[model samples]
Target: MINIVYRLKSPKFFEESIDEVELDGVIVRPTHLSICQADQRYYQGSRPANILDEKLPMALIHEAIGEVVFDSEGNFKSGDMVVMIPNTPFGEDVYSPNYSYSSKFRGSGFDGFTSDLVNLPEDRVVKIPDDFNLNVSAFIELISVAYQGISKFTQMAITPKDNLGVWGDGNLGFITALLLKELFPKSKVLVFGKHQENLNLFSFADEIYRIHDVDDDVVVDHAFECVGSSASQSAIDQIIDIINPQGTINLFGVSEYPVPINTRMVLEKGLTIQGNSRSDRVDFVGVVETLKQNPQLFEHLEKLITNICEINSLGDLKDAFDKDYISKFGKTILKWNI
Candidate 1:
C-alpha cells in the first residue's frame, strides 16, 4: 500500500513522500491527530537549534486516535477504533512511564503517528469504545498524562484536601482541572488564568480567578502548574504562595528554560513538588475506562477541541499546524483523511 507521510524538512515546511507500508503488524489509519505545543515548537523553529537539527525531517504529531484497518495477530478486529500510545519503552523499569530512561517518545525522539497508516506493536495501542467520539479520542494521550500525574499525586499525597488549585487556563490546565473535579467531585477547584475568556470555558472549576485578582485569603491544599514556557516561573510562584503547608505541587507544564523556584519557601513549607511528562499503558487504560463509564466527561472534554482542520495534502497539513499555532485556546485537531 502507498503511504504518504508529512515530514518537517525545515521550519514552516512539510514535505511529503510516498512509500510502501508493511501491513504485517497492527496497521491503523490515523483518523484524528492533535497538535501539541512540542509539535508547534518544532514547526515554528522555537526549539534549541541543536535539538531541532537532530529531530527535524520527522513526522510531527503524537496525540491521535485511529481506526484499525489490519491486525495480522487478530488481537484487534478491523474497524475497531483505538487510541495510540506514543511512548515506546524499549526495556522494563520499575519507575514511571515518562521517567524510564529507555523510553522513546514519538514526535520527539522518534517519528510520531502523523501518517497515512501507523504500524505499531499490539501493546502500544489501546482499543476505545465503539460509541466514543474519535475527535475526543484524539486527545486521550494528553488526558492520560494528567491521569498519570494525578495518579502519582494520589499515591504521594499525605492527606486528602478539600480544595485544589490549577494554574494556567490553557488546554493542559483545563483538562487537569476538569479531571480533578471529576475524580474528586466534592473538592472545590479554583482555576487561575490571565485570560478571562479562556477562564470562562472552565465552567467545571468551582471558582475562576484572574491571576492578579486572586485574593490572599484563598488557600489550596494542592496546586498544579500548567502554564509552560516563560510563564512557568510565575505560575509556580503563585502556586507556592497560596498552597497550604506540606501541600503537593504537581508540575505538569514544559518549560524550555530553567525555571527558578523559591527553594526557601518550599523548604519552609515542606512542600512536595512533582513533575510529570508522557504517560504509560496504565494511564491510557484508566482514561479510556473513565470515558466509557462517564459519558458526560467525554462531552466536557470535547469542548476543549477548538479547531478540526482536515488534511488532504501537504498544504492542508501546513495549514493545520499554522492554524494551531495562532489559536489562543483549545486544541487543534488534524482530521487525517488523506
Candidate 2:
C-alpha cells in the first residue's frame, strides 16, 4: 500500500513523501495525534545539532490513536479503535525492554504515526472501546509512561508513601499527581509548581503550593520531579531538602544538559533517585485497562487538551506546532485528517 508520510525535514519545516507500506502486520489509519514536548523539540530544532542531523526528516508523533484498517492475523477487524505503541522492543532481557539497546522508538528512531497508514505488529496495538473519547485517548502513550514510572516507583520505594509530592505544573506533573491520588486514596498528593495558574488546575490534589511558597514545616515522604530542562535543577534541589530521609525521588524530566545534583545531600539523606523514560507494551495495556475501569479520568484528561487543530494539509500540521509552542500549558492535539 502507498503511505503518505509527513516528516520534519528540518527545524520549523515539514514535507510529505510517498512510500510503500506492506501489510505484513496490523495497519492503522491514525485518527487523532497528540504533540509531545519531545516532538516540539524536533519541530523547533532544540535538540543537539548532531542528534537533529541524524533524526531529522522523520515523522514527529508517537502519541496517537487510530482505526485498524487491516490486520494480517485477524486480531482486529477493520474500523476497530486502538492505541499505537511507539516503543518497539526486541530481544529478551531481565530488565525492561524500554531500557534495552535493541528498542526502536517511533518519531525518534523511525517514522511515527504522521503517515496515512502505520503498519505495526499486532501486539503493538491495544484495542480500545468504540465509546472511548478519541481526543483524550490520543495521548494514552504518555499516560502509559506515567503509569510505568509510578509502577516502578511503588515497587522500589521501601519507605512510607503517605505524602506524595509532584514537582511541575505541566502535563506530566498534573497526570502523575492525579494518578497518585487515584491509586493512593489514603495518601496526600501535593503538587508544587512555579505558576499559580497552572497549580490552580490541580483541584483534585490534596495540596497545591507554589515552589517558593512552600512552608518549611511541610515535607513529603517521596517526590516525583516532573520538571525537566532549566527549572529541573531547582526542583531537584527542593525535593532533596523537603523529602524525608530514605525516600525515593522519581525523575521523569528530560534535560539536554546535565543537571548538577547535590551529592552530599543525596548521600546524607540516603535518597534513591530513579529515572523513568519511554514505556513498554505492558504499560500501554495497563493504561488502557485503567482508563476503561475509571471513565472519570477522561474528564480530567480532557482539561489537558488546550488546543485542537485539524490537519488536512502540511500547512495545517505546521500551524499546529506553532500554536502549541506559544501555549503556556496543556497539550496541543492534532486531529489527523491528513
User: Over all chains combined, what TM-score does candidate 1 have?
Assistant: 0.97
Clashing pairs in 1: none
Residue pairs with colliding backbones in model 2 are none
Q: After superposition, how far is residue 147 of candidate 1 from its true place, in Å?
A: 0.7
Q: What are the runs in model 1 whose C-alpha is more than 4 Å off? A: none
Q: Which stretches of candidate 2 lie over 4 Å from their true place?
A: none
Ten-residue region with minimum lDDT total, candidate 2: 89-98
Model 1 RMSD vs true structure: 1.3
Residue 128 of model 1 has an lDDT of 94
Local distance difference test values of all predictions, in order: 0.90, 0.93
For candidate 1, what is the lDDT?
A: 0.90
Leading candidate by TM-score:
2
